[model samples]
Target: MAVSLGFASGAIVQEFYVDDDVDRSIRDSVEAETGQALVDVDYGDVVDGAIVWWRAEDAEEEDLADVLVDAMSNLDDGGLIWVLIPKAGRPNSVRVGDVEEAAGIAGLHATTSTALGQNWAGVRLTARPRSRR
Candidate 1:
């Protein structure tokens, strides 16, 4: 998962912010593969990427937008934010449209969606291009 996320051992610490509710197995896999520990929400430094666990039942569009914005605020320019939501048929699963709408509000766009784990699906989000007004 670390390699897939483009992480590698380097002189600089490659930090990835982890939002709440993500499975411990996923975090373990990443940590074991990257030889680095994932940082939590309280991390004060900029991150190379982020993994955000979200549930539709727990939030509204505005809530998700806020979370996404805050999660990416300390991210690097080229950083990727992976939003992990419950899979279809799973409890609290989120619709793709809801994710896209919230991402748009957060000044981001969804580039891809994939199965992140047995119970979770993931959407990769990147910053939207700014208009040079």
Candidate 2:
């Protein structure tokens, strides 16, 4: 079964730093199920109204946190950030605790996590509500 990230049709989604295997699977599933194309973008792309598919294990935790913060500028209000990481016990898998800490630093919270495929896990996140000034 294809996993749902709560995306709607025509929603703009970006794939950032995911490996070839994971990226291909996500692209196929998103296109087939949601009709939303996952745009491949680098760190400097100006993005908005897009679900960001980030591969957390590609970088160190501290670097990933910084990248998340930077990605915030490109995200639209209510946009989802799906962080893809190597499955537990895999060589390059990121620790769950690191993911949580990075989310906190980036002002987002993880809503759910599920297996993306045989080699990857996906963590769905959303921006935290800002306090009224």
Model-by-model lDDT, in order?
Answer: 0.71, 0.67
Q: What TM-score does structure 1 among the candidates reach?
A: 0.79
What is the per-residue lDDT of model 2 for residues 20-65, given as tens digits with 9 covering 90 to 100?
5554666677776667566766635544433434444456444766
RMSD of 1: 3.8
Q: How do the residues 3-108 of candidate 1 rate in per-residue lDDT, one tens digit apiece? A: 2544444211232333455667776666665677877777788776777778876584438888888877777676777787889999889987788888999999
> Which residue ranges in model 2 land beyond 4 Å of their true spot?
42-57, 60-62, 129-133
Q: In lDDT terms, which candidate is top?
A: 1
Mark the regions of model 1 whose C-alpha exceeds 4 Å error after superposition.
1-3, 8-21, 60-62, 128-133
What total of clashing residue pairs does each candidate reach?
0, 0
**C-alpha RMSD of candidate 2:** 3.1
What is the overall TM-score of model 2 with all chains considered together?
A: 0.79
